[model samples]
Target: MTRTLLLFATILTSTQAQQGFGPLDPTPPAAPIPQILTHMAQQESAFANARDHYTFRQDVTFETLAPDTNQPDGAYHQLTDISFDDAGRRQEHVVFAPANTLQRVTLTEADLDDVAHRLPFILTTPELPDYTLTYLGRQRVDQLDTYVFDCTPREILKDHRSLQVEDHRYFQGRIWLSQQDHQIVLIHGQAVPQDTRPGHENLSPPFTTYYQQIDGKYWFPIYTRADGTLHFPAHADALSQTVHVRTTVRYTDYKRFHATVTLHYGTEVPTTPNPPQP
Candidate 1:
């Protein structure tokens, strides 16, 4: 009878083990998120090959809508001609309205030296972070398996500023990155508040950016669309002294290496004054 009892106890213990009710834990360690971001950064950093000088042409369209306006009211169309050197330094950014009509032309040479330092604000800088990556989750964009992540602010001041009682100024939206190359194929998120007002303090706009591979190395945005509300003081109402203004910007029709040009990069560039004609 004692032997029979021992056998029954052993059988019960085995049954529990088989049913996953044993003493051992089952959860596995999660993959490090920073490591994934680092991997993405490494891939993007080596994308573009170093060249002596390269130029790209871009078309820009900007529109702003007033309060309660069904359509965009303020519209502007312009073209940008940018040149970069082998060291990935911007030499010139000639902005024209149409037919080479010079609206604003920047020469890295003397007399216009100050503006050259600010080129990174407009053109891509070699050392800049490829993207702000936050692990979103596994999702599909365009029927392809992708990992969703949030692009955080790579700039310090831009990231620390809060939007409202509980909001982050930078990286408040979500992005979908392709699992294959870890490239940001689609981005959907809200824009950081541009102004501080009573009801408008925490306002955020919806922004989307789409990336496509260019020259097989670089992944640049082929298309982008963003719309957001800008708040303004209500003229007549004091208690409710703010109205939402809609604004949008879109980019299309990209052309690469339109012209062969020479680039000179340094703090000082040789200036060539207009040669006096006889």
Candidate 2:
């Protein structure tokens, strides 16, 4: 018989604990940050790439509050199982998806992309040459001490699908590294939010992602959250329209997975079979 185990609880991140220290309040980075940042970026890239082999569950929720009254207006939630197919492709099966008032507003694909890939920026060795780094001193996360760094993309990248907007050009944000292991424990930042190209105005709320040690080796993203104002061009009614929103996603149920194989011998052998010698 096989047993099922629960590894960790769902992570609900709090920004209040993160605001305790500024990047340069007490002191600045020690020195030699450029080389250190590059090395750490490579490690982070390897870490993110390794997660495709594991299967986990994600719980995501979105809520909007009335700007006039600050009351909850609408909300939607879903629980999905993220796994890989035999061909080595990622798949998300929605275990739960509840209907809500989110459909009333126009949510473009770009808006969804902003929340998905744009916010959780991961710096790798390949992408390092395109950006510059700065030391942001130290910060305390829970009981662990971490080194902070500011990352800014040097040049603007052209959009492949459509005309480029101001926000789609660069990546500007901060990353937290564990002082002991140099693994990225947290990241707080977003894409440039200065898009003003007519109907293509791209606005993203600054979000923070927290990573936890898995199997005492690598740190993986376990929680992500953002609470900020969302402006849509389709907004007409002030009361019914939602400009302020709270989005939180929790990842849990981390279980190791590997393909199972059965070996066939020439014949079945019993453990307690009589000896061949007579």
Candidate 3:
């Protein structure tokens, strides 16, 4: 009897380690899952619209590390100010951009686009139908009580053209939403639909984005980081290689652009104050 009990305890510990979480609470949420999903989607839609009216600076860094030393052997760095033009057209002004030195992996346009948009993912009401969201129960994120959910795309569309490497990309990950505000506070996942074609391989690493309450109401992504190893299989001309890469993106200096734009969320129009300029 003693031996059997000890073996069961060992198995339970191993299972927890692999799953990354203990058993979820059997108690259901206060509201139905469908209702919760709709509310969260609406809040996210409002946040996305409000973010566009804010001007901020983004600093991005990507590095390929040496296996032995775990230090950067090659790197890419860029700093840009994101704001709207007089015509309210979104614009990005590069403050500083250095030559890329990465040798193993080349950064594609899609990768940079992901850094700008997908890293700070948003699932709006219209986008809700394109994804499948499953509630994973309640979890505490620092001091805030949050509801956890797994989000994945319903389909990955592929272009049939031989030259096209990728057509559509989607965020495949988990999100933590603040229970009080129904706003996303954190996202952990990666861009999916990575092309594994022999000669044209495109892969993305998993990443995490942490949001901070900006202007006292909206949760805005402030920092994001990704670390992973990408493997490229051998093709007709080249041999296989594995590259260890790390990326970090920081969004700061947020100030609401005083425009005529109006963003509404659940009948509430929260006032936003302009941040002090440096």
Report the candidate with higher TM-score, 1 versus 2.
Answer: 2
Q: Candidate 2 lDDT, tens digit per residue, 123-203?
A: 667777877677768878676778877877665333333435633444578888887767788888766644644455556
Which candidate do you rate higher for lDDT, 2 or 3? Answer: 3
Structure candidate 3, residue pairs in collision: none
TM-score attained by model 2? 0.71
Report residue 93 deviation for candidate 2 (angstroms). 1.6
* Model 3 spans with C-alpha error above 4 angstroms: 1-26, 85-89, 157-165, 259-278
lDDT of 3 at 240: 93
Clashing pairs in 1: 51-86, 52-86, 132-151, 136-148
Could you tell me every candidate's TM-score relative to the true structure? 0.53, 0.71, 0.80
Candidate 2 regions with alpha-carbon error over 4 angstroms = 1-31, 84-89, 156-171, 232-242, 260-278
- For model 1, the stretches where C-alpha displacement exceeds 4 angstroms are 1-32, 48-54, 66-69, 91-95, 98-133, 154-172, 190-193, 197-204, 234-278
Q: Where's the lowest-lDDT run of ten residues in candidate 3?
A: 156-165
Which one is best on lDDT?
3
TM-score of 1: 0.53
> lDDT for each of the candidates?
0.46, 0.68, 0.84
lDDT per residue, candidate 1, 1-278, as tens digits?
Answer: 99999999999866654542123222221446665556555655554332213455545444555457555555544566656655677554547664322221211122122112211111123433634554646754544456666555554334444434233233345655556765556666644434445443334345566666655755555555556554444433444323332323333333455355676777677789989999
